[model samples]
Target: GTRGPLAGIRNLGATCYINSLVQSLFMTPEFRAHILQWRFEPQQRHAMNLAYQLQMLFKRMAHPSRGFVDAKAFVDSFGMGTAAYRQQHDVQELNRQLLDVVQTFIDKAGTEQVLKRLYEGQFYDYKRCKRCGSVTATPSPYQDLSVAIQEISNLPQALKAFTTPDEIDGVSCDTCNDKTTVEKGLTYRTFPQVLTIQLRRIDYNRTTFERERVRQDVHLPLDVDVSELIEKSVVGSPNASDDQDENRFELQTVIAHSGTAYFGHYYAFTRVKRVERDAAVEAKRLEEGEDATEATVGGEWIKFNDERVTVATPEEVEEYIDPASWKRRHVVHATKKKAAEKTKRDAEKKKEADNNDSNNVNDGGDAPKDATEPVTDVATTTTEGAANATPSGNAGMGTPVATDEAFAFGADLFDNTGAGGGGDSDAVAEKSVSGSSYYAIYRRVDLPLPSATIDTASLDVPEYVLEATKTEDDELSRDAAELASLRSVVSVGLVYRGKKHWVSCKPETTLHELTSTARQVFGIEDTLHLRLRAFSATMSVLGATYPADFTMADTGATPGSSFTLLGVEATTDAAIAKDVWPTQSITEWDRLMPIRVYQPEKETFAYLRDLV
Candidate 1:
């Protein structure tokens, strides 16, 4: 939805499923960059020419040209259905085919190819026999890992579930040379530069004999450790100076499927990494002699729904994955408080005025009009026909009533319309309501705002010393705000899951307050775990915690600078700061093994997530 030329893809029927797959791959910056450089050096790059077609199609997709790129050739190569029929295709099926194309393309281009550098990974296969207890090991190459979802709620749990060993009976073992009980295990031998974890949401139902889809919400973390899944052990230091043995992965693009197996829609939410750029240029404005504003750019997450693209917040992206999280938090509005106060004050003032007027007499029925009164109390009617007609009830409603201030105040409140309406008339006969003197009475009726009291009970302060502690805390909060206002302000954006979002904040705000504010903004109560990532003009900082002691102004972030607010699990009951459970090194796996994905040559997801 931002300022960009958007491109649309023609539905072409059930092709929407595959369209989601294509869009997901196209948005991966490294992969797109590799495809853009396709020279087709090898003519038979992947025998079916799948890679060449993909490069051409993706290039067109990235182009700013208006019309939909012809994806017919690319879709046809998959052999899902008749070209003319245009039947629906499964996303995972198309996903595997696309990987095969890339893998073969890399093979044809040899070891030095772009696809090979990005997609190739080594995996180890281990099988152990119960008879002799000898384990056999083998290695194989992979473009991606298809991990079963297993109905787990999070990525770490799903990967853990996937790595569980399978038991097989009556299997011939090389060591035993006879049929025996054996266990088969698959673990990561190496990690690809662009590691893709396919959530196997589709599974077979034994009773129904049909492919069933899983709709349960599954959570993914911003940081995940797959080192436990590695078959080999770290040859060097586990926590090396470079920290590669950690083998952590950051979420990049998510291809979310929203429908059942028979019918569904596909869209993607992608993380746009930061790059060094000037705000003046990105904003398309640069005043002469204006100081240049530099920034760590691309801290935004955008959603691609077919051709329609829009910016999304971290909360929105989370809600997209899990529908239950979509409920928004109720807001505490300051205006509503003011309105409530005004209402109460007016009601009290009205009661007081009513009591003051109750003791006066109404001339025992009808009285002669006073001469000095510029406004009339009743219709002339020859002075009410000299009271010849019947005298109406003095206290009756809808009668022309006069306030004591007809002459004392002004004529504006008299409702001096051509028709002799009273001062309380709905219509203003002479002066408009704005110019009327009624506001004078309104000012008199308004009472002062009452002093606010600190809720000691909520603070759990004992009644004996409640007054003493409440006074101290309240004074500190007020004085802190005033002092913080003296410093310059820093604007921050919340970065969570796979997205970065903008949030407004005052200058001199500290991280502890920031966390509380974010909780309110996102409608979270109780425990909220948030970490701030600050970006400077040239680079971004990592691991900034929000403590009450430090203010954002202390971090040296620019006014228009971007920050990433990463959401973490809120822990209770003995939470360790680092090297804790789940994230603790290599213990969760059934079998201990070395981390295999550490390589300085290829950049991993961990490096990208922390990219300055």
Candidate 2:
């Protein structure tokens, strides 16, 4: 049976299952490794404590649902339940034990030695600051080196058999040592350290493997012509070998140690060049005024050029190429071609016109009678009358004929509408017979006149007129007045989603009631959500310190009211009391007083504020 408060809860079966799950979740290899790396470290202790607290809080709040409860019950009823719990408990205990062991190993190994081995045999080319004139210790002691090597090698096996390879690189100097100082006079020394190991296979590079395979399969024939082979290689011929005569390889390795610790072990291989002189020449040129230039030989170096090499002046170079002169010559040649084409076209047009004139002269000479026909007096009078008329045959000669009206009538006539065929015959006849009419004869003839029909339906009004009418009937106008009144009552602006919200309420209204009214009137259902979030924030703050009273009110003049924000004050008090005292004090009145006070205050403020 469990001891203390959990004594009666013992043998409940559910408790054991919960404990096992918690242990399994928290005592995994990854979690252990993380704890080992950071826990107890002065810099990381606060963060670790926060994480642990949050985890415990989350677990306490989580209520196992129906499925999880059912599963737990079934498992607990089985005979294997006890064995599983034992296994998880044993693992948890073992992990805790290993943590102490790891710490001991780290203490014995020494951090300085471990850091040095991490960069062993690597080309670090350490340089000392000229001002400080500090040089790193050469060849750290053998005892420290062996301890570091032993610790690192044993770590892989010690970490609960988690086989995933990991590499970490760390650098620490005198400055870092000063920064990582511990309590007391002892200082935490720092040195550069790096560790490299594969963690997990997240993805694979198939393309890289295929390319490597292709590269290995390539071969070249020894008997082939040298120049032909070169050309074939440059042009990417299928028969050309990728592993040609020029190929070479380079490899590098390094081992290092620090005070009682292994720093690192590293190895690498890369392609090397056979023509050492070529590299020398490039290096020399780089040092001199000459820019590094590629050899004329066709290969990777074909496109390379020496940008630093000075040659001819800009003017001299331009003279040599003569691009401007060439452009001018090209323009002159194009202009001459265009001129020739234009002259040919003009000559063709003139010839065609001369031929047409000669044909007209011959035809007229052959038919002299047709050309000499005279006009009769009636025809002359008719022509003169038509010219003087309004063209609509209307005798009302005062009626004006606008150009647009005349054109429209012409268009209608072409479209076969009779409106343009002739003006009103009766009116024209009446004007023609009138003895005093100056345009009597002209009125008798057909003419065009403006159409009298008006299209009143086609007129359009501007959009601003409709908008203005809508503005006159808007509900927002009333809401704005109410908001103004609410603002006068509240001192602080009401906020929703980080923006100030205008309200309409009387002064002395509580924030809680105002929020409720705002929700109903403004359809702001999210007000409750906001309150809950604020309550959470208040609780968090109260977890550290308890305040005297918690009241919420809209500072806006509209619908002014105060609502005693409930639960927050009590919740805050509870959290602070719990954290500070290690246990809660029991008093029925103590628990209920805060709630009772808050509820009445909320109701009173809400009621009085709404009256406004």
Candidate 3:
């Protein structure tokens, strides 16, 4: 069992980015224990203190009776204004700001450098001048790595690319006194107990003058080793050990985005530990009448989606890694669908035959319970659910209803479709789960716990948290009836001039209505005629213009499907410009062959060349 029931964070508007980061941080065992044990001084204990607010939030999250907790207090203390809360910001930015604020507060409170001890690491930026052979090594500190992942296949590959040496264009060498290229790269000087990596999935396209997303799915593993990436000079030195076993890390949590570069939803997958100690060791300690803390290295996985927290299989977690994996999960397999239909028909026929046989037999007690599949086991439950729910017509916009495995949190807690579809035909809206991974957190393997146990007395929830909880409960009671209407409204992106703006509407909204809404979002006047073209998530060939009166439901246009609205006048201008000065290349033959070519308005190509 977990130390406490898992809890989710309420989204304060477009605050999914913050919620995802907070969930991952809360799951970090070392970080959680340290924050809980920090004894705040009289002066440091205040509502404005970020560390105190975060500690209180964590304490509420660990409450046994709560399904979720409100983070508005903490968010307010974090200083993200109400306007910022309504707009989506990058998760990495929040991660850095939160850590920095906590570090600042910890310093003021005169506590140990908890953030530095767990999340900070040192690296060297070295430049070797080829001419002078002089090397300059600059040591720098970092709490996390922001790495470019374009064209990279995995975590290690991305790290390697980040550290790859690049030549400099010009420099005055200190020894050689010449401007020449120099090889520069990075190497790890020390590894932190917890490592946070931010995958930069968005890139700027110079030609388009807009930010575009790299939809490549990079493979992530349960464990990662950075020993090989350490500086060669430090490996055998007294500063570092030759055998760097401590450099290994295990996946603790992941924060993934699920939309385009302009807008998206954020969610997290976290590894939850049930027991933190070896069973034999714990048993022996208990037998000796010593207090033994429940701890373990192995753990189950869970997903935190806004206010919904549920158990997630290791396989299901992979779906959030990248666009390819997410798209693969939504593909409609015709063969499998047909086979499932056939199986259902056969089962019905068998049931009819069994009923006929029962009518002839005199012995009728009850159906054997042994024939039914066991529901107690997790794997068994998942298999049974999958068998009953096969891919159906709603595969385009909704997930297979039968595949939602029930757990303590309830199966209906999450809207399976990213577009807010609740497994109903009327609400069958397509969801775009295909997006690049945004953030990941890793814990050092075999990291030793603090020598002194955390003081349980210091882990009390603050009064502010209690008051906030009551307010949240009241709000929830009032908003319960409005959730259905909220789910029916889905957001789709409208692209113009290489930029995407999202517009919200129901699935039954017509193309004309959608266009009108999109135009308003873009602040376009009614006089400008707009040309609409649709494209798949993968940027497939642009589909033909849709009829203005056709509803989104009729064409199965789901959330994240891009509809480009091109102004008729702007498009015509581009076409005319292209035709006026179409790029032409001059053709000439060698002097020895001296040839000139000319053509009359109606002359054939062969005749024109001969005449020239």
Q: What tens-digit string does per-residue lDDT give for candidate 3 at 1-612?
A: 223246688988998988888888777767777666666676877767888888878876765445688898888886767865889988888888888887776645566787898888888877888776777787788889988887887888887787788888697777678888888878777778898998888899999999988776786655788887776652232344355557788777778888888988998877655334376874454344342232322345677888888876533565554334333333323334445666896699799999989885646655447857543565565556555554566443533333444343344455442345544222222335544467888778786422112233455445554555667555654575466555566566676665667666777888777667667777776656654544333442232234456566655555434343322112333333223112221122211122222222442222212432
Index of the highest-TM-score prediction:
3
Local accuracy of candidate 1 as per-residue lDDT tens digits, 22-107: 76676654565555454554445442577666765664554343334557767666655464236666566666777667667644
In order, candidate lDDTs are: 0.50, 0.27, 0.64
Candidate 1 least-lDDT 10 residues: 436-445
Query: What RMSD does model 1 have?
Result: 32.5
Q: After aligning candidate 1 to the native by TM-score, how far in Å is the CA of 573 from where it should be?
A: 88
What residue pairs are clashing in model 1?
232-594, 233-594, 234-594, 417-429, 489-507, 495-565
Using TM-score as the measure, name the better of candidate 2 and candidate 3.
Answer: 3
Model 1 residue runs over 4 Å out of place are 1-6, 40-49, 65-70, 76-85, 102-111, 129-133, 168-181, 233-246, 274-299, 320-612
Candidate 1, after superposition: displacement of residue 392 in Å? 46
Q: In candidate 2, which residue ranges exceed 4 Å CA deviation? A: 1-320, 364-612
Stronger candidate by lDDT (1 vs 2): 1
TM-score of 1: 0.45
